[model samples]
Target: MQRIEFRKVIDLSHIISPDIPLWPGDPPVTFDEVASPEKDGYYLRRFAMGEHSATHMNAPNSFHPNAIGIDAYEPASLVRPAVVIDLRIQARDNPDYVIGIQDIEKWEQAHGRIDQGSVVLFYTGWQTLWDDPRRFINADDKGPHFPGIGAATTTFLLEQRRIAGVGIDTHGADPGQDTVYATNSQILANEGIVLECLTNLDQLPAKGTTLVIGVLRLKKGSGSPVSVMAFVP
Candidate 1:
């Protein structure tokens, strides 16, 4: 491969740490100092975290039985064309809003039909709550509430556009209340990547940004933490 040139780069990943909001039952992020300069000649630390926590990508195995893992994704496929659909106003009006086909069509009316193999992203203004776990999670007796792609919408994208997958600035690709993970499962079930907890969607335009998704090549791993970057044209 030739040396890659630089461009206006924007990071679309959340900073992972103990304080990052996590799934109700997922493993906690922890770091322990295994060696320090005071005790040893080197400074080193060990860390533990869940695959789905923080900013991450979900592979087919995450939802389907006996499916391929994160490592199976071809390197060339990881860097993909991406498009963002701004739904901040709708999400602000209703925290539990689910993006439907109509919303996607409305975006297309302005941005043109989404190209095949593109990764669609939804910017719901949720990134603003990153610092506040209380509001970011927004859980209640019912369940967590946040904006996400609807199952039917996911079906449309897969069938109509044959997109690579979808991403969101939330913990799950499905609406937070959808414990069944309808949207999340549907995408991965069809072997599409589902990027979650991404940030800086606000900085990306409706199109023209190429996504450079970085996922750990974990063998047979259901999912892996991701560092998603955008190269704006």
Candidate 2:
């Protein structure tokens, strides 16, 4: 028999702080010191933030009616093989780009087909703009201007490919400027999970990596801020 060891664990989640970008009109994260070391001989703090803030996951019920909650996902389902589809070039050239079915086909041609239960993450290079909330959200009077998965592509992945879930380095799975948000609606209809606001995707290879999503097991939670990590062996 042989023993196994971890090669590396990369942090794919972003830091949750005041600087982190939040959805428009969302509540700001706050930290309060409950106890001081000098007074209580201990340090205690209380923090509060929206469930959808930072590196977070959307459960089926987040947008669906009476669907499963975040706590319902089994432990086995939280960890899965992951493939990073890089669209940095296109995203850099066009801020309002949407990853379409053609992009998925191109990736399948380069690599192998995306298997069932594999976590598919889109690398839009949006993490580079995280330092600036205005730019990261890319919003204006019209709406947001960030890259997202096209509705058709989301349908193909959730219905046809049957992937475990979809992850993005942006605000959400749908384009910010999309009024209808058909992609997100489609995912909800299928009871699909979504991981949003991911970071450090560049550190992982396009394939041959495992994604570990650590989320708070809040009962009936529509969503939860998650700590996303990658195990590379």
Candidate 3:
């Protein structure tokens, strides 16, 4: 007897909610009902939260001076072919691991060159322990210990590959340990974007996928929370 096979697809994005861990100092997400059928004629609710609360987009103005506003960013830039480069091995060994040139080289050696205009998503496997504050932040006397793209690697992707942007499964594009926000500053200055607080990347194939980031059109806003999704073929 012969068996038939079917393609399996997985979503590689996080669900944003009030309980999702947010960066310290940001206001907590709030939801309140303004009217209800029991009290009035209909039901209506209101929400209040920072733009950068959960899975979100980062505009040039986020770190650069007088950069493009979040609203002005082209919608076309939000969707693109993507490549997932796994750094879980290094991250497991070093919680503060920074994705570097060597990592890119290794990936290219196996998967060929990362195409220009691709949205490179780095998988640190940090999302697995996101619920634990201690493990998520790994805060200490020095600072938080989380993984992110190194300055050199980010620069290389921007200058060499001319990538559209970068994404990560961690809280920020810059590591919790980065003091200068080097990668963020440079990337934004170059008109490159960053998608942060992503999850479920382990379900995606390394290549042959597309990432769609839906950002709210906030007038003159620096950055905003985004509804992210991945399409696999």
Candidate 4:
């Protein structure tokens, strides 16, 4: 058995609440009191939210009609080495910026080639806007605009590195303006998972961290909110 050791843990998930920015028309998050300590000797709440709410993972079925769901993932698939690519400066310069081969090559020059089966994450500095839904979504008549992976980058990661998944601190894996979900579809087509709306990415190193994702295994679920934590060595 492979032993796991870490000196610190960084929460890579956002606190799920009613106000986090969501896709344009997804169901709103709701929390209702199911029982109160005074009345039932227990405090419990029932919450409802879209599968891809807050910090969430996307199953292949999210974009593919006949693909497997999140529950199909095995325990080993949920724990893997993770690498964070810092693109905050570039994303801030252009919200529509698409991570491309040039970007990946540059990152590799500095960090090294991305390892196979690693979950690659992008820190676009978007998490800073989580408090303001409008700004976070950054939508207008033209549609949302945010830095994200595109078809080319997604394909490179899959074909070259054989990445297990891709993640970002934005609401969508594809750039917000991409209604077609180009990146999502490509990644999902190969049975790769997608993580979004992640937080605390600023606390992570460029590489050498293990991601232990906690996802709700809803049967045939297209996706689910997740509690992603990073094990820092």
Best by TM-score: 4
Write model 2 residue lDDT over 1-233, tens digit each, in one string: 63323589899899888788989988899989999989999999899988889999888787777988889888867878889999999999998998999999999999989998788999999998888999999888988899999888988998788987789999988888887777767775665668899999998888888888899998988889999889887
The regions of model 2 sitting more than 4 angstroms off are 1-6
Give one digit per residue, the lDDT tens place, for model 4 in 85-193: 9999999999998888888889999999999999999999999999999999999999999989988998899999999999999998898888788889988888887
TM-score of 2: 0.94
Q: Scored by Cα lDDT, where does model 1 land?
A: 0.89
Q: Please estimate how well model 3 matches the true structure, expressed as its whole-model Cα lDDT.
A: 0.83
TM-scores, one per candidate = 0.95, 0.94, 0.91, 0.98
Better of 1 and 2 by lDDT: 1
Ranking by lDDT: 4, 1, 2, 3
**Candidate 4: pairs in clash:** none
- Give the least accurate 10-residue stretch of model 3, judged by summed lDDT: 2-11
Instruction: Pick out the ten consecutive residues of candidate 1 with the lowest summed lDDT.
Output: 1-10
The number of clashing residue pairs in each candidate reads: 0, 0, 0, 0
- C-alpha lDDT values of all predictions: 0.89, 0.87, 0.83, 0.92
Expressed as tens digits, the lDDT of each residue in 4-101 for candidate 3 is 23255455556655677777777988889999999998999898888777778888887877888789878777778889999999999998888899
Rank candidates by TM-score, best first.
4, 1, 2, 3
Could you tell me how far off, in angstroms, the CA of residue 86 lies in candidate 2 after the best superposition?
0.3
Two-way lDDT contest, 2 vs 4, winner: 4
